[model samples]
Target chain A: MWKALLYKEWIKTRWYLLLALLVTLGFAGYALLKLHRAVALMGAGHIWEVMVTRQAVFIDQMQYVPLLAGLALAAVQYLPEMHRKCLKLTLHLPVPALATLGVMLAFGVAVLAVLFGLGIALLAAGARPVLAPELVGNILHAALPWYLAGVAGYLLGAWTILEPTWKRRILCLLMSVLLLRLFFLAPVPRAYGGFLAVLALLSLCAASLSWLSVVRFMAGRQD
Target chain B: MTRFAKLFFWFLVLVLLLWQLPWAVNYLLVQSRNTPFTLYSEVLDDFVMIRHTSDKEVEYRDRAGNEYTRRAFDSLLPLFYARQLTADGRFPDSVAGRPVTLREAQIASFIFRSAPKDLNRPAPGLHFLLESMSGRVDLAMPSDAFRLTGRGIEFIDMAANRIDTAKSGRFTRMLLRKGCRFPVRELSGNPSARKEYDEGYLLLDADGGLFHLKMMQGRPYVRAVELPEGLRLRHLFLTEFRSRRTLAFLTDESHRLHVLTMPGYGIRRVEGVTFDPERESMTIVGTLLDWTVCVDGASAERYYAVSADDFSLLDTLSYPLSERRIPGLSFTSSSDRYVKPRFR
Candidate 1:
């Protein structure tokens, strides 16, 4: 039953996921290309010095790509369901309603993980030749929170889309904006540090928020 | 599942409210406190303050409520405004009954500032060790950087992204021979070529021992600085002032400020001054005569005048901060770089 639900979501969002993959990877590749071009123009030493002394992450261009990818993916996956009123039917499936929504949220989260993981791996592999391990670690640490925000963005996007009433959806949207604001609060590299784990947990807990929307939808709540 | 979801939803709402409401109120209600620019004047034996009046005009006064004209103010702080006095042909031939020159006054002056945000942030583990005796008219950045490990130090060539084992082993051996422990707890250095000179870095090791490590002519110049008994240092600021009289400013675990003097790395406690480098911001404007140390604390901005020779307290003044703040949840702080839930 879980596989069937997962397959349905995949079939619905496969094409969008492919575009997301290309767009995200393209942004990551462009950022790395810029870093390499910098190295080629003005030796690797300059790049290393800037990264060390000035906290230059080099991949700053890709900071918002993951966020947009997550938001777009959530819209592609859930907007159709909510628009066609298919969520009501999906909830009435043999499987439990909460379990059904859980599977859908899990699928979005998993695909986002794979997409963001590939972007991070590309950055690491491309940066390895020119940067030392410490510089590479700095870039990764700086990018970690942005990638976490992608996960939080997806979950909150789903919560907002799946919400039944227009007024309630606006409230959820406000809350989501404030919550996502947490991820980009500090501009310093690796500023999230240990707090990143808490952010990841909060992103996961955001999964439950969609269930509240589903409960309201089941209760026939409307504007 | 629905019950749990509802509970979690309300928890997030409460968190958002606590974080946002106080922030909004503070943004709307709080006004920034404009602390006057102040300095100790040896001529007056009191702090001279330059502040803006309600009419936006500049006012110069001392703690004794005596105000002075702008030219009189310039004469009061001659060391600070030496150029203005010299240009006006009113420069004193001697100050405090000692022969002085414009160049002498300029070279003897330095300003040192440290804020909690600087000390509270993440350190990029890697450090540059420039050649201190390269015989060049202008210093250059090194081609490699080093990191401290459990066993010793490793220098990585920046261009090749490879460890230079030969250079690494040389410095590591010298550090080990100096009785330095592995995995330094705290390290401070001024590596810029713009500085007049380089003193490399001061390292606090795992065993609470202090070591000075620098590069000279492509070789290691490591010295194990002996600390006073039970003196556990917490932070270090390597000062490369033009005076060349002081090496570094240190703060101990008990929040007392200490100065490590040059020629002999003698550590002397700056009497009657306590600066917690993790919470407050401090600035020291020093001259040949005395230092005006200003420590901005939570509730007050305290100033101390200490003798430049012995760092003994000469006088003290403070202005209480009156700006009100609404306490609530804050994820980021002006004093730190990290994002964590904090309530004050």
Candidate 2:
């Protein structure tokens, strides 16, 4: 039953996942290309010096790519279910409704983890050859909050889209925006170091928020 | 489950309100500090201030409340307003009964500023060792960088994108011979080539001992500086100012500002004041006679005028600054480079 449920989620989000991967990876690749251009124009040593002395993170262009991808994934996975009332049938399966929702969220999160992991891996690989390990770590640290924002965006999008009524969805959205704003508060690289672990935990905890929407949907709460 | 979810939602709402309400109030009503531009006048033996009046007119006054004309003010702070004094033909033949020249004033004067954000930031773990005696009029940025590890300093040659073991060994051996502990704690240097001179870096070693490292003529010149008794240095700013009177401006754990003088590497505390580099901003305007040090604090701007030769407090003044702000929760601060939640 779990396998079938996971398969159903895969069937629903597979194309969207591929598109998200391509878009994010394209942005990441573009950032790498810019770094390459920097190295070509003014030697790799110059690039290293700028990064070290000036705190220049070349991957800033990819900051919002993960966020947009996450938002899109949530929309792709949940909007159709809500639009066609297919979520009712999904909940009516043999498995418990909460478990069903959990499995679906788990699937989305799993796929996003892989996608974000790939983005970070590409960044690390591209930066390693020309830069020192400290610089590579700095670049990675700079991108961590943005990647976490992507995950938050997905979870918040799910929470809002799965909500039963218009009025409640608006409330959910205001809260989501405020929460998403937290991830982008500071422009300094690695400024979010001490807070990131708590933030990531909060992002993962946010997955439970969708269950509130699900419970409201189950209770037939409508505007 | 519904109850828990409902509780969580309200909790988030409360958090948002707590964060935003005070910030909004503070943002809308916060008043700017009307701090004056102040400097010590050795001729008057008093602090001079140039400030804007309520009508937005410039007013020059001494600490004794004696008003001065703009020309008088320039003459009083001759070293500071040297060009203006020269243009007005009011450049004095002597100040404080000592014969002085514009060139002498320029060479003896220097301004040093230290901010909290610069001291309370993350280190990049990499440093460039420029050739201290490159024989060029202008300094050049190095092609390699070094990082201190548990064992020794490792230089990474950027062109080859690998560790330059030979150069690394040379530096590491020099530091080791000077009895520098492995894995330095905090290091400070101005690596930019735009500066007048390069003093390399002042590093605090693992055991809290101080050391200076520089590359001179393709060889490592390392020296371990002996700390003054009971002084544990917390922050260091390598000041290679044109005057070159001091090696660095440092703060000890007691929050006292000290000047690391050159030639002998002697440390002299700037008496009668405390400056926490992690919280306050400090500005020092020094001339041949006296130095005026201004410490910007949370509630007031404190001024301490000291003798430049001895760093003894000559005079002191302060302006109580009242900023009408409703303090609240904030994750970002002007006083720091880190992003973490803080409340005030």
Candidate 3:
């Protein structure tokens, strides 16, 4: 049943997914070209200078790409299905709302995995020097902080779309942006681990909200 | 009040503040002394804190204090290096004691005066002096521009170019290659290497010039060297003898303050100066004005000031601006060695 639902979802959204993937990879190529110029200016491997100089560019990509991909994937898969007459027929079958929601999520995840694969390929091919174990270690070291930021954005995006209220949804979206900015920009004291704790809490809140939005959408809507 | 809405709202606040990490650091420094030092990434936005304590220890506090110390120092060193490089550039290498290309004894003299580039604290503390070895400009000068031994270089700037060998007024340029892991080519018009010369840890002076051995990588010990002739070995209280090399301020029969370099009791030298004359009931006090170097005959009170300033006071020592005050006047130093200071 899950495989059948996934097949149905793919049938609805394959074209959009393909287009999103193509455009995304195309943009990645353009970005890598820019990064190559920056790398040349940075010499053999002046990591710090390269980082500082390309900070703005990396920031733009990180902020928009993943979640925008996720959103696009979601729209392609679910929005059309929910509004179609076939959605009601699919629901009337023995498949539970949970199972149907699961397949939709799995489809969403597949799209995400493809996008992430492209990013990894770019890193492996172009960022060879920076892709070393130590640099990878650095990226891992920063994983927790950026993970929290991403979760917050993800939840906020999911919630704003699924939530019924206009004003409250806007507020949540604004909160997500604010939380992301604060965690990145605001100078927090290093000791006592207070800042990290707060960021963890915000990240959890975003994730929880996203999960709640998805569950509510599945349970409450057939069309 | 939708559940989804609340979540999104908080995320917005977080991202807004976190994204502008550089600006946020600036804001923290401006807002208060307390702010954490943070490095930004999409995954991780904020970081640890740092602070300075009364005990002179740098402590990493969460989010605030650590950053102030780092941010303040990070922007400060380059300005200092640049200023020292630029000012030192203004000087011919011969002004600072250059190496003797010839084996024979020779004398070289020139004049040097420079101001600091940038400051961390204020006018007085920012003074730094520098010396460079790699440059051909300093090397191309006279053989005896400065008498070099294990002690250090000597016979710095003065009136006329008196080094026996090498023509005066000759200038040249050399490339200063700073060996970083990643190489960068920068144009150096007049660059001198003086990092070790300006840092405040070492004090190189006395009848026999002594450098305090407080700062070290492993073991710590004060290094002592005797200075050249026509100099004094006195206490390091430079306030009293601002600009004047020999002590003329106080009257002591046994503790006479004219320092000359002759294989003294504590003199170490390629050419070092010593001051052994003592007046009854006297321990030396106050450094002479930084600009003035003095030579003495016999008495503690009898010394001549070799002034760096243009005002004629070679036969005597006088602080035209200080009017014989010490604390108000400031002295500039190289990263390691003390350079001559002018009145404020």
Share of real interface contacts recovered by each model? 0.85, 0.60, 0.09
Q: List the candidate 2 regions with Cα displacement exceeding 4 Å.
A: none
lDDT of 3 by residue, B65-119 (tens): 3334443343222211223434445212222232221111111121121112111
What RMSD does model 3 have?
21.6
lDDT scores of the candidates, listed in order? 0.91, 0.88, 0.35
Q: What is the interface RMSD of candidate 1, in Å?
A: 1.0
Q: Is candidate 1 or candidate 3 better by lDDT?
A: 1
Model 3 earns a TM-score of 0.37
lDDT tens digits, residue span A1-223, model 3: 7777778877877887787677666655665565556656653233322232222223235435544555566555545544453445655779675465545655655555666566546644654443233232323222334434443444455555654445655765665555455434311112113445766565554545544554545465422
* Global local distance difference test of model 2: 0.88
Better of 1 and 2 by lDDT: 1
Predicted model with the maximum TM-score = 1
Task: Assess each model's interface with DockQ, reporting 2 decimals per model.
Answer: 0.83, 0.65, 0.07
- Over A1-223, each residue of candidate 2 has an lDDT whose tens digit, in order, gives 9999999889998888888889888888899889988988999889999998889989888888889889999999999999999999999999899899999899888999999999999999988887789998999998999999999999999999999999989989999998999988765677887799989988988888999999989999988
Model 2: per-residue Cα lDDT over B65-176, one tens digit each: 8899987788888888876888888888988888889888888888888888886777778889888998998999998998989999999999778999999999999999
Ranking by lDDT: 1, 2, 3
The model with the greatest lDDT is: 1
